[model samples]
Target: MHSHPDDKSLRDLLREQWTVAPVRNPGFRAEVWARIEAARRTPATWGAWLRLHLLGVSMVAAASIVFAGAGGGLLAGARDRHEREQLVQRYLISIDPHQSSAGEGAP
Candidate 1:
């Protein structure tokens, strides 16, 4: 809780302390802007950018390939399991038309 005698005097003091003086050198702004403009015009070439990040890109590609192989293997295993289940069902149906699936003796 500030108990300032007046708001105008306090605001004036703050402005005097915190305000940034303009650059006296007229060419300073122009020099900075020229460098920024030059950077934008040339830009980083794709070849140079890719060269800098080649390791990361290669790692991502390898991970993708590994995940694809793992997914394919999982699908193959599931398919084999389903086929085996179907074969077992067929065998049971053929062997036991009257045989209870619960191993109960048919009357």
Candidate 2:
């Protein structure tokens, strides 16, 4: 038989309620608010933000364009057709011995 009780678990200890005290210093809030206001008023900060946003939008647009182009079978069909034409031309050229001979009427 167990002589000692089981140890109180962390969960049991955390189950008790706790009170949190507010920050005593008011200057921290005031300084933070001032910085927020400064950021809002700064044209340079706003411009940088806008530029970053535009760059992100441009990247998304470019990726979407590439996806749409490839997904629509445009590039694939064109590449296949080009390859087929190249193969046909190669076959034609290979069969034509006169075309490969250097200097006309040599052999």
Candidate 3:
């Protein structure tokens, strides 16, 4: 009996037929170099970019903390029955009763 080709063998065959070539666009290269020079000349623009990046990073960090506290119940510390009940109550209060009852509140 003949054996069928496996996924790995097929992938190897496809890879063997493929060829990769470096991109060569002189116009695009020149545009990128010009942008680089322009950026270097504008120190204030670089500083503004850095400040905006830092602000964005801070916002992301704050949002991550809030999301973790909200979704993972990280602020609850441990799984006690009373805390769990309170959390469930808060969730029920926030959501529509029909939706909450439909098991949409499981997570």
Among all candidates shown, the one with the greatest TM-score: 1
Name the lDDT value of residue 98 in candidate 2: 51
Q: Each candidate's lDDT (Cα)?
A: 0.80, 0.71, 0.74
Error of 1 at 77 (Å): 0.1
Q: Residue-wise lDDT of candidate 2 within 5-94, one digit each (tens)?
A: 454664455556555768688699899999999978666776676775888888999999999988879878988987876676566568
Better of 1 and 3 by TM-score: 1
**Candidate achieving the largest lDDT:** 1
lDDT score, candidate 1, position 88: 67
TM-score of each: 0.49, 0.31, 0.31
Task: Say which prediction, candidate 2 or candidate 3, comes out ahead on lDDT.
Answer: 3
Q: Show the colliding residue pairs in model 1.
A: none
In model 3, which regions exceed 4 Å deviation? Answer: 1-29, 38-52, 72-78, 82-107
lDDT of 1: 0.80
Tell me the tens digit of each residue's lDDT in model 1 across 28-97: 9899999999887663888876787899998999999999999999999999987877676667778976
